[model samples]
Target: MIGRRLLVAAAAAGAGWVARAAWGTVPALGASRSAIRPYAAGSPRYRDNRFHNSEPSSSLPSGSQSGLAKAFLTRGATGRPRRAIPLAAPLAPTAAGELAVTWLGHATALIEIDGRRVLTDPVWSDRVSPSAVLGPARMHPMPMALEDLPTIDAVVVSHDHYDHLDQSTVVRLARTQSTIFVVPVGVGAHLRRWGVPADRVVELDWDESTEVAGLTLTCTEARHFSGRGLARDTTLWASWVIAGPRRTVFFGGDSGYTTRFADIGRRYGPFDVTLLPVGAYDERWPDIHMNPEEAVRVHLDVDGGLLIPIHWATFNLAFHPWDEPITRLLDAAADAGVTMSVPMVGQRIDGVRPPEQKPWWQGLA
Candidate 1:
């Protein structure tokens, strides 16, 4: 009988350890709805106990619950590449230039404009989830180490999504760099929870602008939802307008198709370059994520010069093939006569004088 009791105890202890490991990063989930309400309540979009988009949008189509469930279970190997994806070694410039962008896979990119660098949606973790054990892991390794990045003037976070705003990366940057974090309103609560000093965080609502290192970072509108846990839309999500003395750039951080792009162009049009997302799209979530063709429309709507695509080629977040996004984007851009540069992971391209569009991704898919 004593032997039986000891065995049961051992089994229970093992289960407990597994549970602990799975939930170890729960604290990194960021501030709760109550903690964020104070900062978010003032916005016009905040009502009905949450933020709302300017246009009506649903995350998934009606009656898609069961179909999506079955799809998730049956869609094997739908979003992965056929073989290994190629990567390019990022070449660090001696100094910040007029305008250039180095894509570091997914939505992370370094934008150098007028002698300053701004990092957008910096996620450097192996997996993007509250728990380290489970989530969509990186398809390819990081082309460059996080510590090797050049001095950045500011880190701009579009929203609180696990993929876009990683808690581990935030903590590391806070400990290593002295740069301030510019985020949409209510997201500062997350940074504060992650041990980033309050002074180091700046929160802004739509249309608000903040200056960092002689550049203007404006929080613009986006059609997207925000949440880190169960409660949704407690914080704001946004696109950004980065304007320098000599150049301006538009960063479309995870948004759907919206006519607001025309409005933004009228206000802050004629950008030197625009970084738009071109992946993870589905008909079910049509209003929440734009397809590649819609991305081209956004660039033209904003009167952008050179278009560089982001938000693809890292983690698989959709049901389409891995390379389909870029493939469709190239065809659409060609039809629209849109000048674009599809850089390899970690490759930097000058916005003013971009290199020829290389078909490096050809045959890799």
Candidate 2:
């Protein structure tokens, strides 16, 4: 009798574990590998059965497996802020023919240029992983809800990383907004699988351009990789150039510093503004993610007028202190004599006439 009862308890525990695993994967793993292969096969970067970076890169450092494991186990409140992160009440941008940017946080910004608007790498979900219940959760609440955003002309995604390309957010945007999704090659498969209308997805390779709402959107080069699971780099990664008739903006979705920025500047630059990533960086992955100083260099290489930093202050993806990226960025920009805007999350800055710099992050540190 005792043996039978123990066997029954073990079976029940196993069943419970299976149910949890299934629940965690719902609508998160995205499209299957077979679905993405058709478009992935055509690009030159998509050789070796995977995408390749222009320069060699790795997501993590070498000789650091034990160090990484120790760091993860002992993060100990060092990666977050002691005080609450400040939030700004975001204003709806409506003035036409004016250039502006409202940084929503962590590589997600709403760019209003000329008469149209473009949203970059929008991830509204609470966590950025294959499982919402088990991943890096947001340290601060989003100041503005997704439903409250003004009508967007286009939505641009830079890569297939979970943080940049969220399944739930894509589904919600499909249901709520009529905006088209302009993504790097092979990303359309995920959108289609998530029920986004096929007509609404525009897949572009590097150096490709498409006109939308009187603005020219161009996909450019970036040194990064992409994947949602064990199978890696099955899609392309890119920086973007969004040019209006009167103004141009560069969206450095997420990239390490590469010489291509100078080429991009000469080809389609002298941009009115540049939004570059300035967070979640470490020595181990220098080739994949740029540090704050490198971002300023990219801004200069692109002949950017105003530099508004992104990819920080939202999720704690790296081991650095929460405010370190922006803090170091301020010092570097001052040294470089580069004009920059460090807006509070959700704060809107007029691209033409940005306000004076304020160290809003000082107190939070």
What are the per-residue Cα lDDT tens digits for candidate 1 across 1-365?
Answer: 99999999999998987786578477878998888989998999899889899999898777988998888778888888888988999988879888899999999999999999999999999988888867788999999999998898999999999999999899999988999999999999999988999999999999999999999999999998988888888999999999999899999999999999899999998999999999999988999898999999999999999999999989988899889999999999999999999999989999989998788888867
Highest-scoring model, TM-score: 1
| Native RMSD of candidate 2 (Å) | 2.5
Residue ranges of candidate 2 with Cα displaced over 4 Å: 1-26, 95-97
Candidate 2: tens digits of C-alpha lDDT, residues 1-365: 99999999999988877676467575677777888989889898888788898878887776888998798779988778899999999988455448999989888899999979899999998888877466788888888999988899999999989889998888898899999999999999989988999999999999999998998999999999888888888889999999998999999999999998899999998999999999999888899899999999999999999999999889888889888998899899999999999999989999999998888898786
lDDT at 67, model 1 = 90
RMSD of each: 2.2, 2.5
lDDT of each: 0.92, 0.90
- The window of 10 residues in a row where model 1 has the poorest summed lDDT is 20-29
Root-mean-square deviation of candidate 1: 2.2
Alpha-carbon error at 206 in model 2, in Å?
A: 0.4
TM-score of each: 0.95, 0.94
